[model samples]
Target: MLMSATSFLASQIRSTIAATVHSTNTLVTSLKSSLGYLGKDSSTSEPENQSALSSVPLRHEQYPSLQPWKGLDRRLKNYGYTMPVSSNYIAPRYPIVLCHGLFGFDKMGPDAIPHLQIHYWKGIHQALNKLGAKVIVARVPRTGSIIERAEDLHKILSTTMEGSPVNFVAHSMGGLDCRYLISHIHNKNYEVLSLTTLSTPHRGSPMMDWFRDNFGVGLLLQSEEDAMRKLGEAAKLSKEAVQEASDALHSYLQNVAGRVMSSGYRAAPNPSPISPLLNKLIPYLDTPAYANLTTTYCKEVFNPNTPDDPRVSYYSYGASVPQIPLWAPLGFPWEVIKAKEGENDGLVSLQSARWGEYVETVEADHWDLNNRWRLKIGYDQKPFDAIDMYMNVATRLYNNGF
Candidate 1:
């Protein structure tokens, strides 16, 4: 989830792979192209575009931001980014749609806020827009079963692109939504050119089992009715508003739990009996949706149930923190996942995140994979820039003729 954090750990990654060579070649070519796109020239003795390189903000302070998270914004607003003179500024033939994971909000929050103020994709859309890519941020509900979320996304696609084909770049559960939509929503004529999933739980996560099993206290807090009443009391919002937000929160949690809690796990029976209040509030915990996410279900049922479209290229990019990071809030889950799954991005293990053409892995947690490291308040070390990674994705897509 994209909010703050979670807890659990594992050490082994299990998956059946088809072609490791495809992963290597695609990763190497993409990195090389991205480096070249940023004005680095391996062919030349010196920097090919020294003039363009001179304009880039080289240091954190030089970027003009005391807030680390806003550094990318400052750089974009001030210096701006330009591709090498040899390459085209605008790349992708089709529009790029950014699909967000759980807890993702299309706009910042509430009706009064401006769009993109606190985007789920952070400044990625802005940065891509600047580079002449046609980027549309899809606003599906933060949580829901793949079908429910996909339905929402399908409606958005109908309105946004009419029927034009698009390249989708999704994160976490968003990838599942994309896969669901691509496979099921055939009437829409929405030709999905490529699907790139980032740190998605393809085979599901055991963390969901742990949360549904032992965390009764936390579940009580998230149970729809409680969250709504609490917010209603705290914010003094209208009854209608509170109910709506509460319903959304509940739906989100339903999908979150649905993504991992299934029949195969050691988790106690669905509609966890640990908390009577939670059981009452979330009576429909074990649905077909939830069942679809279990490793057993996914491997034995869902994978075989869902067929990959030969026309649409599929790529997966997974991440791992290796160790607990400076983001203390995310450390618990990261550590837990590390211990149990070998290494993870605090949520989905790298193995669970793999799908089609497996891309290179990164030394980043799930949140940081979306450039959340930029928002680390106290951390001074610049880990990595997700912007570059995204740019590289767009570049590779462009190079491939879509």
Candidate 2:
């Protein structure tokens, strides 16, 4: 009986080992196929058609030099993501207009203080210009409605390009501005040949909705009456004092709201424990961008009104980071956005970023899309050079005869 039990136990162990080996082999084969290492006809020697290659998903072998961060495979497989070749970019036919997004600027400091000037596009504009592309960095309002931004963009383009056909490469909210311009604003001065958006929230972001619902609406509801009552009591000593004070308070609140809400992502996270002083301040901070950027607003209002122009070619690239570190500035917001949307680059989701041709998705966050390398820390799972990506866009436009 003992001998028979020992033999049975040995047989079970052998079976388990065999199963494990089979599963491992199957996984390896699947990975190989997904990475473009298997299922190819070995006899085929002809190069793939350029148009056909564009449609085919990029493979790991295509980017031989991409060195992802160490241990990234153990945490989250890099999969050798899609990024443009580092060199040899063909300049597009028309000048490339680089449009900044919400709360963006061409330069921050005054011209006299050139050493301290901070550029929105950073190294991107200079890199593109070096590659023989005529780059125009457009300056628009930091925090304005889409219509307002579009109007400003149109004016800038008309004056700068001067009847020259131009290609627009917009990031974040700038993409919406360009779309609005293309669809609604008709200008005879300059022609829009094409628009390529990088990580733009075309459909709108859930983060905006979350901010408005949780903090913006609550602040407005709780503080307005209290602030007015306090102001009225303070000004009651004089004969028309209350009325004058009320008017002054209303105007002051409007100005404060614009300034505060317009700060965009730079604003501090929503703090729940509102101090007495903060209660008065919070209610006055109106989100001017909320009406323009909420998912509901874009889907129900902006999209319906802003249809794509047939004359212009539209293409877009979305981005995503595998993980958001605990200490990352976008950590809380990333979780908030991820809860509603499946995958995102800490700001815009991959699904929401898709528009027009839908080129490809890269491994990056919102700031990384703008070529802000200094902002990226301890989250470099993939080597996605923003400069290279822009150059690739220019190359694509050139190839398409834009």
Q: Name the lDDT of candidate 2.
A: 0.71
lDDT by residue (tens digit), candidate 2, 10-84:
999999999999999677556545555554663333244333434555433465433453224322212222233
Q: Estimate each model's TM-score.
A: 0.62, 0.65
Scored by CA lDDT, what does every candidate get?
0.64, 0.71
Q: Give the runs in model 2 whose Cα sits over 4 Å from its true position.
A: 1-87, 110-114, 217-279, 375-380
Please give the lDDT score for candidate 1: 0.64
Best by TM-score: 2
Can you give the lDDT of residue 180 in candidate 1? 68
RMSD to the true structure for each prediction, in A, is: 20.6, 17.8
Model 1 lDDT per residue over 1-402, tens place: 533232221211112132466687566556445545343444533254454444543443443332355545434422223222112234578899898887776666656756425556666777688777898888876655565678788888888887788999998888988986776455575678999999988887666645544532122222332333443352344656645654664475565552222233334544555567766655444333443354544454445545677889999999886565646676666666666676788888998899999988987778866655345565443366677678778887888789
lDDT of 1 at 183: 61
